[model samples]
Every structure is written in structure tokens, then in C-alpha cells.
Target: MQETYRRSADSAKGRQRRAELLESVTRDLAEHGLVDFSLRRAARAAGTTHKVLLYYFADGDDLLAQALLRLRGQRVGNALQAVAALPSGTLGDRIRAIWPMLEADATGLRVIDQAIGLAMYDPARYAHLAREAAEQYLAPLTGLLPPEWSSARREEVANLLLATFRGFLMDWRTTSDTTRIESALEALARAMDREAADGP
Candidate 1:
């Protein structure tokens, strides 16, 4: 009976170890990106073996998805908090305030691009992550609006801003053209002013 109790306790220990492995994996992704991710490499980074990593994650993609999700969550949460910290401003003002803060390091950008690639490659496996990402990024912005706006209206504003931000960021990444991106941001700023002045 005591041995069975010990066995159950061991399961909990296994879970804790798995969580620790995940943290290490996410750290590895943050520092080095996931370009060469494999069961053996990831296991080595986590200070474990391939068989042990397989015990925790079914495959490389599974591990990658989970690690990327964790990384995205941290970034999204920080952006949301930063947006909330700024003084009251037009929706556009708040949007502009957060733009510069969102620029990630080379490794961070790699994580973002690679994660998006993963979703593009297998939407079914990563669709939930993609959805969660949008939701988390959009969630905190709803509070930036005037209290007079309806919940639905606030949500619409968030959706539009989120879409615009992502599009501009993609353009910046693709063209390496900050001049054009800044112009676009100015346009967005004007549009935000108009939206704040004219309801809906």
C-alpha cells in the first residue's frame, strides 16, 4: 500500500519535472530560437535524454508549440500591462505608445516568425495557439476606450487596431522600411483621432 502511495507521489514529481523542462525549453527558444529544434537537441538543452523528453512531449512539434505558446504569452501579457500603464489617451494614442515597445530582439523576432510558420504549416495543431495569441493581445486594449462605448464597439476597435498593428509589423519585417512604416503609423494615428471624435 505504501509503495502504491509512493507511486502516485512519483507521478506528481514527474509533472513538476515536466514543467521545469518546459521552462528550460522556453528559455532555449528565447535565447537561441527554434531553428534546429529536435528531440535530441531539445532534450540536451533541457539536460535530459531523448527518451525522457518523449515521455514528456509526444514529438518535436508538440514541444515547439508549447514552448512558443509560453513565450508568446509572456510577450502579450507585458504589452497589455504596458498599455494599461499609460495615461488615458485616445485609442490611437494608446496604440502608438505601445508600438516601439513591441519590437523584439533578433531571437524574439525569430520566435515570432517561426511560431507563425508553425501555425501556417499545421493550423489544426496550432490553431488554438494562434487564436489564444490574438485574444490575449486584443483583450487588454478593450479597456483603453472611452467608458461610453458599448462592449461590442470596444471589441471592434480592438480588432481593428490589432489587425493594423500586425499588418504594419509584417511590412516592416519584410521591407526593412521604417520610413514607410512610420508613415503608416501616422496614418493610423490620424484615423484614431477621427474615431475618438466620431463615435463608431
Candidate 2:
């Protein structure tokens, strides 16, 4: 019994340590961006040794993927909370509420773009992560839509909104032209509102 208890305690401690490492890496990636990320770099960011990171993660890619996913989760969680507090209205209203939150996190967006670029560059290793990232982002956005709409309809709108948002984010990253992007965003929102009003 004592041996089992000791093992359980060790397991709990290990889990907690792993979580701390992950959190540290996620914050580092969010601030520094995910360019040429290596296990040694992650270790330095986490204030731990690479061997320690390997004990908790399979490899550098695995560590990087988890950090990116955590960053994405933080962004999505904040957006959901902010948007939920707002009164339900048109799709345009939701879009307007979400864009500012996303815009403010330019670092987060850039890191995510970098991860997507990894997938494009090395499909054998990173494509699954890109797909996972898409689903993780899409589900919450879809849930925010009106419940009366069919699953098909919600998913369709969610895909379009996600794609549009990604495009605008990429553009913003490239140009830093807030005025142009904001204007385009407003136009997109207005168009979505019109479509929502028309209904299925």
C-alpha cells in the first residue's frame, strides 16, 4: 500500500512539473514567436534542461505543437468569455467583438501563422497539428452561432469566418495596415450580417 501511495505521489508531482514546463514554453512562444524553435531553445525558455523536457515530451516538434495549442487555447478561451458577456446579436456583432481581441494579440497570431507554415513546409510531421488547430479553433466559433441553425449551416459559416479571419490576420502581419484591415473587416461583418438576416 505504501509503495502504491508513493508511486501515485510521484505521478502527481510529475504531472504538475510537466504542466509548469508546458506553461512556461507556451508563454515563451507567444512572446518570442515560433521561428527555428528547438528543444534546447524550449529548455532555455522553460528554465530547465532539454533532457527534462524530453522526459515529458516526445521531441521538439511535440513540445512546440503543444505550446502552440496552449497559446491557441488561451486566445480562444479569452475570446469566448468576452463574446459571451456581450448580448447575443447579429453575426456582425460577434465579428466586431472578436476582431479587437484577436488584433491585440499580434504576437499570438504570428506564432500561429508560423505553426501553420511549419505544416505547409513539412506535411509529414506537422499536417496533423494544423488540422487539429483548425478543429480546435472552429468548434468554439461554431458554438457561438445561433442554436436554431443546423450543424451544417453553423460549420459552413464557421469555416468561412475562420478562413476570412486568417486571411486578414496574414495581411495585417505583412502590412501592419490597421486602417485597411479594419475597413475590410467592417465590410466582411456587414456582408455576414446581411447573409444572417436572409437566413436558410
Model 2, residue 68: displacement in angstroms?
A: 0.9
Task: Please give, for residues 1-200, the per-residue lDDT of candidate 2 as tens digits.
Answer: 65564455359787888899999998788888877678888899999999878778878888888888887887788778778878667878888888887777755656887777778899998897789788899998898777778889889989998888888877887889999999999998898888778776
> Considering every candidate listed, which one attains the maximal TM-score?
2
TM-score, prediction 2:
0.88
- For candidate 1, write residues 23-128 as lDDT tens digits: 9888888887767877888888899898777677767777877787788777766677777787677677777776776665544645765566566687977676
Off by over 4 Å in 1: 1-12, 106-109, 121-128
RMSD of each candidate?
3.6, 3.4
